[model samples]
Target: SQQGEEDPQALSIQEGENATMNCSYKTSINNLQWYRQNSGRGLVHLILIRSNEREKHSGRLRVTLDTSKKSSSLLITASRAADTASYFCATDTTQGGSEKLVFGKGTKLTVNP
Candidate 1:
C-alpha cells in the first residue's frame, strides 16, 4: 500500500524514559515525515527525512530512514508527560498526478508522570 504502516500500535512509559516507534511503507516516497498529535488536536510536524537522507534529529527527537527497507523509525529521548500523544509517519506520494500526504494509523504513546 502507498500508505505508511506503524508498528507497536500503542506504548506506555514513565516520564524521563525513551520512546521509539517504527513505520513501514510499500511504495517509493520523496520524503517521509513524522507528526505528533495531542488528543483532540491537529498534528504537529516533527521531522522530515528525504529519500537520500539516512538520519535527522531535532532537539530530543531523532528520525531515521532506510529507503532500501522502506522503513523509518522515530526516537524520542527523555520523554515527558507532555509527550503523550499519537505519532504518525507520513509520506508524500502522487496518485493520478496529484500529490498527497499518506499517513499511517499511528502509534499512541502514553507518558505517565
Candidate 2:
C-alpha cells in the first residue's frame, strides 16, 4: 500500500510570508497531488505532479516530487489569511491490479494578518 505522512503537523506564519510543507510516502505511485481544506469544508485541489516530473507550479502554489527519495513538498508563496488551511498530499497506489488514493495526516497552516 502507498501511504503518505506530512511533516510539521502545525505551522503558523504571518501574512506575505511563504509556507512550506513536506510529505513522505512509501511504495510506488503514478502521481502525487496536493489539496487544501479550509476548516470543515471539502477539499480543494491545489496541484498535481506526475511521477516523471520533478516540480510543478500553479499561481502561488508550487509542488515538488522526488520519487527516488519517496518524498514531496508543497510551497505556498505570498501566503494570506485565506490560505490558512489543512494541506494534504495524496498518492495514487497502483498495485495488486488495483488503484487507490492514500492521503497523509495533513499539515495545519495558519497565516496571521
Candidate 3:
C-alpha cells in the first residue's frame, strides 16, 4: 500500500518568498519526517513530528501534523536559491518488529533569484 502522497507536484517561487508543501498518508504512523533533496543527491532530514505532536519547527522550516486527517504540511520561510530542491514527507511505520521510513513522491520546489 502507498504510505504517503504530496500535493502540487511542482512549484516555482522567487527568493525570499515562502514555500509550502503538503502531504497525505494512509494508516497510523509512529512519526512523520520531512526531508530535502538537491537534484541528484540524497535526502537530508529536516524535521520530525511524532504522532503525539501537532507542530514542530526547525530553523526556517515549520511542520504541522494532523492525525485526524492523516495529513502534514511543511513551510519554508525566506526561501533562497539554495533552498531550491525536492521536498519529501516520510512516515515511520513498524512491521513485525522493525521500524521503517516510507517516503512520498515529493514536491519539487524551485526558488529563482
> lDDT tens digits, residues 1-113, model 2?
33899999999999999999999998889999999999999999889899999999999988999999999999999999999899999998786888888999899999999
What TM-score would you give candidate 3 relative to the actual structure? 0.97
lDDT of each: 0.95, 0.93, 0.95
Clashing pairs in 2: none
Q: Return the TM-score for each candidate structure.
A: 0.96, 0.96, 0.97
| Model 3 misplaced regions, further than 4 Å | none
**Per-model C-alpha RMSD:** 1.1, 1.1, 0.8
Per residue, candidate 3 scores C-alpha lDDT tens digits across 16-109 of 9999999999989999999999999999999999999999989999999999999999999999999999999999999779898899999999
Error of 1 at 73 (Å): 0.3
Full-model lDDT, candidate 1: 0.95
Candidate 2 overall lDDT versus native: 0.93
